[model samples]
Target: MDWKSFMEGSKDLSVFALALRAVILYIALIIATRMMGHRQVGILSGHNYLVAAGIVSLAAIRMLNPESSLTSGIVIVFVYAFVNVLLSYLDIKWPKAIDRKPTILMKGGMFLRENMLDCHVTLDNLLGQLRLKGAPNLSEIDSIVLEPYGKISVIKKPEALPLTRKQMNLPPKMVALPTILIYDGKIDEMNLHQMGLDHEWLITRLREKGIMNLKDVFLAMLEANGTVYVSV
Candidate 1:
């Protein structure tokens, strides 16, 4: 076997070269994304999706074709990002012209067949979405609107909705998001600091659960109720 050649990679494109290209492309993508802003990664509009698709295609071309220069890929990625930003601005200014309006699929338990057909949504597809959204029967739903981004928004009928704690005169309780203390044997010191904790507290908690070494922990989370959940 040609083990030396296998380890070194092909003459045209070495493994090291590929790795370097990947890292550079990854960093370039991150910079491009940041320039485009957070909206690019959110529920994508039509133009946003197009820009994302173009970026992916350009990156793939650069990775597959070693003859293609990384500088060219980076330039194209930025170009696409800027174009998306421009389109997003235009969408905000002239929404009716640049963006499609949400279509009402159903209202008052009645399906709008014309709107459904216009949106290219089949009856089965609508039913499946409704089922997924926890509305088994049409009577349970007040309305269903199809967003521009192909997501279905269901509004349950007020009379058909379940009773909430507010309806029963129950007081609300403060809820905090769970913080990860450790993951995959690595301590998240930043998260600990954010939660106003330190290493000493985590060590004491672990030792109480008979876990001496941090490396032995698979996962450790600090719950909202001041509870430490540890998994080995």
Candidate 2:
């Protein structure tokens, strides 16, 4: 129960020791994350995920087993991290060395059965995935490639593409980016100042919109084109 008992590698780890171990593991993981330079959770490849899972498992062992050395666990983490960094560098130099290229799952409205089978992806699952990727109609899709990171890339047929403004011979219009001027009935003075406007102008706009009490207005937005949208 005491610090001395915990430090002596006592068989029963006290709650304090466990908490301290947890903090150490947290910091270790943070350092590992920084070393890996991978910020996005979903962007890691399957192999990277396995490495991450292994590091977590080691951290778990340190937390669960009083006999397990925290120093050893942390060293293992850095070892994994170093190997990962080395492999990543090699991967950049030689792309196919670590991860395979994207697999063509479908082409010209026909499924690549061999690739799908190799990936262990069922036909129904592929169909559902395609739908989720915004290709609901298989007939409209020109191709579908399974990316190395496990995402499906959908390519629609040129004929199935939506009509564009240029195609219609229409003049290009400037798209307005709306800024929040009022949120939850509170004036965003910072945003107002940023937009080169003042409180009096906002009140005048509110008066024009018949919004007497700022508290009654739920949300208000100002667009780059000087358009104001108010929601009460």
C-alpha RMSD of each candidate structure in angstroms: 6.1, 3.5
Give lDDT tens digits, candidate 1, residues 1-232.
3333332334476667776777888899999999989888986989989999999988887776666777767888888988988999999999889988899999988889999889999999988988888888887888999998878999988999888888989987559998999999999989999988999999999999999989999999999889999999
lDDT of 2 by residue, 1-232 (tens): 5656554356778777877877887799888879988622557776677788898888887778877777777888899888888777777798787867899999998888999999988888888987787778988999999988888899999999999999999988778689999999999989899889998999999999998999998899987677999999
Top-scoring candidate (TM-score) = 2
Estimate every model's Cα lDDT from 0 to 1: 0.86, 0.83
Task: Compute the lDDT for candidate 2.
Answer: 0.83
lDDT of 1 at 210: 97
> Between which residue pairs do clashes occur in model 2?
none
Lowest-sum lDDT 10-residue window in model 2: 1-10
Predicted structure 1, TM vs. truth: 0.75
Error of 1 at 118 (Å): 1.1
* Worst lDDT 10-window in candidate 1: 1-10
Model 2 residue 144 distance off true place after TM-score fit, in angstroms: 0.5
- Most accurate candidate by lDDT: 1
